[model samples]
Target: MSHTKLIRMTVDRTVEAEPGVGPDIEAWRRSVAGVLAKSRRVSPDELGERPEDLLAIRTEDGVTIRPLYTSADDVPEQPLPGQFPFTRGGDPLRDVNRGWSVMARFGVNERDPEAVNESILAALESGTSALWLAVGGDNLPVEAIDRALKGVLLDLAPLTLDAGDQAGAAANAVLALLDARAREGDGVTDRSRVSIGLGAAPLTTLFANNYSPLGDTAKLRSVDLPGAVRLAATAVNREETIRALMVDATVFHDAGSSDAQEIGAACAAGVEYVEAMLEAGLSIDHALGQIEFRFAATDDQFQSTAKFRAARQVWARVADVLGARDAGAAPQHAVTSSAMMTQRDPWVNMLRTTVAAFGAGVGGADTVTVLPFDAALPAGALGVADSFSQRIARNTQLLLIEESNLGRVLDPAGGSWYVEKLTSDLAHAAWAVLQSIDGAGGFSATVESGWLCGKIEEVRAHRETEISRRKIKLTGVNEFPDSAEKPLPVGPDGTVPDRLAAGRVFRYAEPFEKLRNRSDLHLADNGSRPTVFLAPLGPLAEHNIRTTFIANLLGSGGIEAVNPGAVESSGLADAARQSGTRVAVICGTDKRYAQEAPDAVRALREAGMTSVMLAGPQSAYPDENTDVSPDAYLGAGIDAVAALAELLDTLGVR
Candidate 1:
């Protein structure tokens, strides 16, 4: 439960004479003025900086938060814990006695049963609270499954299939195998602690370059799919014990999202799923009960923890709105992000995952899964290094659980100013966005209108700008790029096992909602280009960057550089001719621009342009080596005015 107090700023405390017992308002004013004269007045400078006019920042969800919050921010009508709404927490103290579990996944090689057994044994020895076994294929090799179950107790969370893969066949195949095996052992299939990885399949289908089940039969129809995902979920209910379900955040970062966007998107997705299932005949309790989330565990601990707390408030509000009879009022699961992990300095991922895992635990996540650091680089090439990364992540969680015992406290970050403020802001923002979605007639409607993707794109654009400008420091990638570091090795013979492909496709969609928000690739730099065309190639909202940047450049150069609407192939020739523009500089990011640069350059050349300048780099150029013959480029931190000046000199703009 939150214990912070907010104070209200008001003049109500100032003394005033009562009408019945004292003088009139005029007399009171006169008296106050006389008292004020006794105090010394200060010069203009002494007044210090005046506060900016208070403005409310509204989140995409529609939750409004003021610039400042005080004691008056509390809702007196809001119920306390252990009561309706459960806004403070599921319990008054947030169920602090029981800490959340640390879940670890053991990779099973279908051909090597012994290796699978050893991996699970190592995970258990390393103090992982639950066993997360990522099955190799559709048919769970009985031997591999036995290895995972060898010494693991029935109460422990079992190996489960990930749903991030859109192929229903993979999800169904794992479910069928788990069901078959469970029936052979316990006879009551419901007594197994396992997850079928049903969440986020839809979103996963959108990003996968390969096969996707969400596509129409026009694509591939050979796969037999599950009618409802929860049927797989219900198959291993585990009686009274809460079973783990996967809620992944990988796609969110990969999709090019911000930390706040990650939390907001995940919360929205979860709400949609819960509401949808409930409407389709499942009880609210059962719907939330059988679910869990898997978020990208990045290096940003505060934002990650805030994501967890924000998720709880979102769920709590929904529960209050529903007023369900037997619904447990807790946020289900929190998965860490893998987007920030780098293949360059693979060892650093351990520290990154540790921080992310801590945030999840403190933020009230039911379980935390830290993806291995080297996992970002391929699977087997750096096999030993990847194993170390995984072990380090596990050890970090164990050390926290046993030594620091941070998990022992509920809302450990409750009263702190920073955490409280972050929580309040996150909740209010996410809530508002949820309300907006509701007003728009729910998830499917918003998706149809492209409203959901639009919001994500907006946030993604801002983050991209920050990252490009180096406002956000990714240690090895940008901030402290290693000059002497060797490139991460790829798989031997560059051959990757097909099983990994299945696993990659099987990630939950909710986590990817934010993690996948990353731009497809990094942008190169623009050295000096007079006419820079900022074409936001991919699925991003255009911000009139061409005009703004060119205007600023022209202003510095004592010339008028024009931006001709949005630069496109059809109009490039006309716009350039009409505006008397010469060079066209492309200024989009990797995700969108990298794939579109070649065509844009070709079209520009055919339109009679002599030279093309890339505002970013050749990395974003469509054809790697086939030069559109870009003459110059500019990266983050380059002086915009300087770059433009150089370009003007080249173009004889004076």
Candidate 2:
């Protein structure tokens, strides 16, 4: 064959359609055009008017959730379960026989060993397949593992430790228990079930110093990493199938990290550990096997699902590069996020926990730990799983596995085009950040440099801004808050580890709590909450929505809104004075505002109202176009915190 002929043959193959094909994408595109034409597409006068614009919500992780997904969108190759990438799952069929382990946290009060023993025995007997004991802290003696687990069978329930800084000491105590139990002839039949989270992410000890000057001990603290890895080797050396170390992505997540940041930091930490383990003389498989990845499952259902799937994808890729394809299947343990928990309406936390648990299950977590409804409450406010709270937490899994039968299908969210696309997007985004962290000399090094701390603070500011604006609503605190609710009583207190980490575990609802506290202090001093008067200018229906909106807005900041009933424009000033509030918001429709708001706002301003706000947009009654204008606007788009602060200042509440 001539050279020209060979080139022609190769070029012809590119354009040739040799056989029958599936449905035509061009035909679908034409159909979509027809549908849009027939449906009479509306004009996008506003940004959100367009379907794509309205639905394309960008997450902090830098992933944009599109309105619709299709086959045309680039989808990652769907590897079978337990395969490379491990996006579908690592233990392919594990959930079918034994669904995710019900690992409930059982905090021990060693001062009262009898109560602690009874609690542990009761917890194991009642649905809990594993125990995550608080090993450090004054409540749980660092060396009293055997005493706490006296009645509990070591062979049955898998035991994990959260020993804080004393993690190495705690693991030694547990190993001692295992040795003593072996002498008693009750040994682990399948060591695969045994896991001790000797995961001392020493970086957590240096984590975030709350945007302050870096301390001298901060970078120096993670020196414990080598000791943690060496301690982890003991289990691997014994031929035990226990996870010795952990990648605590939740620490980053709870510290206000975006989903991608959390996973990226985790992968970075895992890679750092892998390198350290290789240098420490452990084989790649042994090193990978000795570690597990832990992530927080938040109430954002699909986000959490994408999070777990993406985490595994990133870890699998990391492991694959390290020449351990089998070990790439990252074992995951998910717990409901503490950052999503609340303090005021503690009961609502159950719903949040349930949703998080469901997401964790759907996300294919190997072990799911649902926090108690009262988990956010102080130890004095809650004991080792109050009966009601513990039952609810455990039953969250029961409802999903037994009742909902969620475990029947392997990788239930596997082929979903949305989930798959989301998982791919999340994986790539997280991996990019992970690569950046690697470039900066790994996880511990990032902490030492305060790069991770700075990154976290940026996200924290964004989240706080959203919360303060009420753009992200907290059901009880910022919306339908219970003003009359009493504070939940705390349980007996215990000493928390003086963790070297100088960071706050931020929640979106935390700012609201501060606002609520200010309100409490105001009430105590003045015998009433800082109040806003509703100066309605029209009928009930016209003014009710805006009035209620303003009320909720001011109330979100712990200020009360007083409505002296809907009234005409002429009576607004009298009603404002009768309501006895300095902040008066004109509430009415645009049409009514053009008719009556001018007089109402004018009257309230002349009637000694210091801060006169309009419930609706200020553009509705522009001073250039009308007789009066509000001093400030109190509406959907305005920053709630700033508005409330100005209002409180006007009211002389603080």
Task: Give lDDT tens digits, candidate 1, residues 152-232.
Answer: 554455344442333344445545555556666854445533433443344323323222222222221221113334542
Candidate 1, residue 303: lDDT? 63
Could you tell me the TM-score of candidate 1?
0.58
* Alpha-carbon TM-score of each model against the true structure: 0.58, 0.86
For this target, which candidate reaches the highest TM-score against the unseen true structure?
2
Total backbone clashes of candidate 1, pairs 3 or more residues apart or in separate chains? 66
State the local distance difference test value for candidate 2. Answer: 0.74
